[model samples]
Target: MSHRSFRALGVALVVWSAAFTTEQACAETPIEQARHVFETRKYTVVTVQLVIKRQYSFGGRGSQEREEKQEASGTVIDPSGLTVMSLTDVDPTLMYAKLAKTQGMSDYKMESNVTSVTILCDDGSEVEAQVLLRDPDLDLAFIRPSKKPVQPFEHVDLTDAAHPQMLDELLFVNRLGKVARRTYSATLDRVEGIVTKPRTLYIPGQQNQESNAVLGSPAFTLDGRFVGIAAVRADLTESTSLDKGLLAVVMPAEHIAEVAAQVPPLESEGATDGGSS
Candidate 1:
């Protein structure tokens, strides 16, 4: 072909390629759109840690020993550094409970001590965090740390009326401190029924504590609006996989007000909460 003809063909090809790229960029599905939002705004979440105090099973009157356990989770609820997590995960307050291995009652004290929480952003900025509030029954915690907040996140929409399609693909984002676990999906086999406080799988007894969903892990529809704070699996019936019973109670955003009424907010940078006995 002549040089002029070849140059014309190359220019036409470049024009077509640019148009295709624009179309692809604008036509992502809702889930794909949501994932891109998270990837761009990941800098606003953080991981928390604390020194949890535990008394020995023995009826000791002095020299109490402390256990320092670290938990990793994520949050994107606020521009003021507020984070979201599992309600039962971090408790710093000391409380009363029965002594271990005996009929004797004793004080089971704990503290909600936060070491440091840092938000890793895409722009190479790491922001620190602190605890805010957590709902006991619903199992969601709101945290905020001490640092200049980053830009507001691409907050998910919370529809007043929404329904989760059965067998639909759901996405869950998990975190381990500063490290992030990849978002995963599961097939909703069945409804398994609902409860007043979305809890772990167990006979409604006073002493069955087998809750599962990781704290701060958010569950959502393919469109990415709020669905529920992850709840524990409810079925203990034998299945091919152990995870068959580990169901997370997807709380609708409307229920957020009810949970807030029960668990009031605090005004300190330190952490505080009592574990259920």
Candidate 2:
């Protein structure tokens, strides 16, 4: 072939490669677009402060009581300050009970009482809140502000949700700990599997371990559709091992919404503070 002909062919190939690379680089993945939307909208990812008191009894060993203050991530589901988070995060009595039984501690007993509940707002304000309902079967806890807010607060619309399939990538948002200034952060996770029997559950990929997603964080599809909240499932059957039974799964938003609908209207006064499940 002539040198001129060879030069023209090489230049044509280079231009084609460059155009393809640019097109690929310009395209954003679904999760990436969802992240942008969440960031711009300033989704309501709040911090929940829980003050819990616990009493422990070990048969003849007698009883002991203690109190602790903890913070957990929660997603605001409505303008009225209705929030949802992992029940286990607020109270771990059931988890402890399972552990004790697993260890064959027939005489072990434990109880937890949520002494105080507060929602930390983005503007550095604190809103007094209380547990409105608790669903242990689903590991979900719904909370609401004690008093009506002067103005509606920003929240995620769980009704507009997405159903993810196995291996599909998803996005979740959570608030960082105090050390990180309690900033809202987003992470990407893939659906490792889907459980259809009993109830629908999305098993997040192991990559979630390296992510900042914590219990109660809201998950969404790459298209920015609400998926559900992150929670731990504890199966305490005699045949199931603890390691295999307890799994981090994303509860379907539909289930959450159905349960949320069951939450009674906010009372004129705060609901009775009781032990969280």
Candidate closest to the true structure, highest TM-score: 2
| Per-residue accuracy of model 2 over 1-277 as CA lDDT, tens digit each | 9999999999999999999999885797675687686785445779999999899998678789999999999988999999999988887788778777766776788888898999999999999999878888898998889998997988888878888888888877888889998988877779998999899999987866433257899887766678898988887755567767678899898889989988878765346663444
lDDT scores in order: 0.46, 0.83
Q: Assess the local accuracy of residue 272 in candidate 1 as a C-alpha lDDT between 0 and 100.
A: 35
Error of 2 at 120 (Å): 0.4
Q: List the residue pairs that clash in candidate 2.
A: none
Per-model TM-score, in order, reads 0.54, 0.85
lDDT of 1 by residue, 1-277 (tens): 9999999999999999999999997798756766754454334334455445554433445545556666555545534545566654564232112111122343434334444445444355656555555565555656554644546653333344245554444444544433334333222222334454543221111111233434455555555444554533333332223345334565555554345344334343444332322
- RMSD to the true structure for each prediction, in A, is 8.7, 6.6
CA lDDT, candidate 1, residue 16 = 100
